[model samples]
Target: MDGVLVDSETYWHRFEDEWVFAAAIEGGDPAHEEVTGMPYYEIYDYLDREYGTTVTKDEFVAAYQDRAESLYGEDVRLTEGIPALFDSLRAEGRPLAIVSSAPQSWIAIVRERFDLGPLDLVLSAEDIDEPGKPEPHIYERAAAELGAEPADCVVIEDSLNGIEAAVRAGAYTVAFRTTHNAELDLSRAEVVADGPEGLRRVFLGSE
Candidate 1:
């Protein structure tokens, strides 16, 4: 949802740099690479455990919640060509779903904002008891909900954790290249898409 469906990573990274790193943690640099795909509260936990944050957990969480209202409400835009891709896939009788680590509330914002309806399924990390991304449970759950085998699914993901989770779930994963994770290793994915155009080609069978 963050990077794959909506361009929310830029806002997230900016918030991380300004609030999480500058005001919360005292460090040389916040290892965003280490926590990019982590759940929000877990990000604070990670920072506190590794670098010691100046703010309390509640404060950190509150700040993020406040920012998220604006970020998802007004700041982010759906990835280019995604609506067309969705239409194309739907036309082919594909059971499309959004399997994301984002909370249901955040996902709802995107869904409602973009009128992304007729979704076969919408699975969030919060819906499951198991740990989020880099863990296969969520992806497995999504595939199950869609009445499909994991191996038969093609999951498009933009984060290392997302890619790992999809791959571990036995799905054919397509790693999406975005500014947020341009340098991250995506070798675990079955294929790598340079951008939205590349992503369209991947699904349209042109890549």
Candidate 2:
């Protein structure tokens, strides 16, 4: 529900730039391009590995939580045409969901802040025992929760990892452009849209 359904990735980059990565020494923070579509724990793992961190993984996670709550609480906004997009999907009886790398709580926060529409399912990377996105578990597990196999569902993904996961799950994926992940190839996805507006046609199979 973040970069896909809301224009929150930029602000999230702010959090990464300011807090989660601020205390680290120079060159320690993740570059914008490095983290697009990556899972939260992976974010922590990358920082821990690259930064020469004395901080425990748990502490880093905690710090990120504190800063994220403060950051996204104020700035997140719904993606353009989301209400129209979901309304159209609902009319078609499509089962829509959010499968994310963020914690369940972060997902909830975004939903409340954006007043997200009804969703058939929502799953977090932490909920599944298998690996995160690009590994097929997060999206595949969400598909299972919908009582549909992965091929039956279509995914709206904005990150490379999410696209890989969706493709591996046998689901159609639509990629959204963002500052970080733009050049990442999404040719394997069923479609790639410049933004959410391009997704309307995919939902209707019009283009």
Candidate 3:
């Protein structure tokens, strides 16, 4: 949900800036927007190659998980209109799921706290047993779990990786510009909106 359904990019930013850019890699954080929807493992690998992390991949992974548990619930801020949107979707019985790069354990807490039980499914990078964003595996798994064809799904994403993943899965995609991620090109997405409130068009089928 970070940088997508909710405003948790900064939480991720803290994790990246501390563990990723500071402790692990000597280089400053990349824009990171292009990689937003990517899985943490893929992200760690990319940072290792591009920024030269001294820590082992496993060490980096552990550090991220530890910090993630601390940050998940407290720091996240929801995207505007998300509650109403979910309510509407639930009312219509349109199958919906949150397919994200965030760890499943962490997402569970947030989901429960937010009363997101109506979401028909929740698929994390962990569920796919594959790499994360930009790969389409997560969303593909989500569609399967929800018993929806890829073409029947509509993905709401925030970053380039999320958009690309949806496109690869053959689903309609809407990119939400919550953070300043315009630096990450998103021309491939079907729709780019100002925020979650702007996403009413998808449910209304006005787009």
lDDT of each: 0.87, 0.75, 0.76
- What is candidate 3's CA lDDT for residue 178? 62
Task: Name the TM-score of candidate 1.
Answer: 0.93
Which residue runs does candidate 1 get wrong by more than 4 Å? none
Per-residue lDDT tens digits for candidate 2, residues 114-205, read 77758888788888888777788888778879898888887888877778888999887778765555776778787788776577666775
- lDDT for model 2, please: 0.75
lDDT, candidate 3, 1-207, per-residue tens: 778766777777666665577677767558667456787778778887787778888987887777777576676766777787878787887877878888789788778767777667877787666777788888888888877888888888877788888899999888777665755667788878766656887566542
Candidate 3, pairs of clashing residues? none
Candidate 1 structure quality by residue, lDDT tens digits, 76-184: 9888888889999999999999888778898898899998988999998889898887889998999899889999999998887788889999999999998888888
Clashing pairs in 1: none
Model 3 earns a TM-score of 0.89
User: Cα RMSD to native, each candidate?
Assistant: 1.5, 2.5, 2.2
Candidate 3 ranges with C-alpha deviation above 4 Å: 26-29, 205-207
The better-scoring model by lDDT among 1 and 2 is 1
The lDDT leader among the candidates is: 1
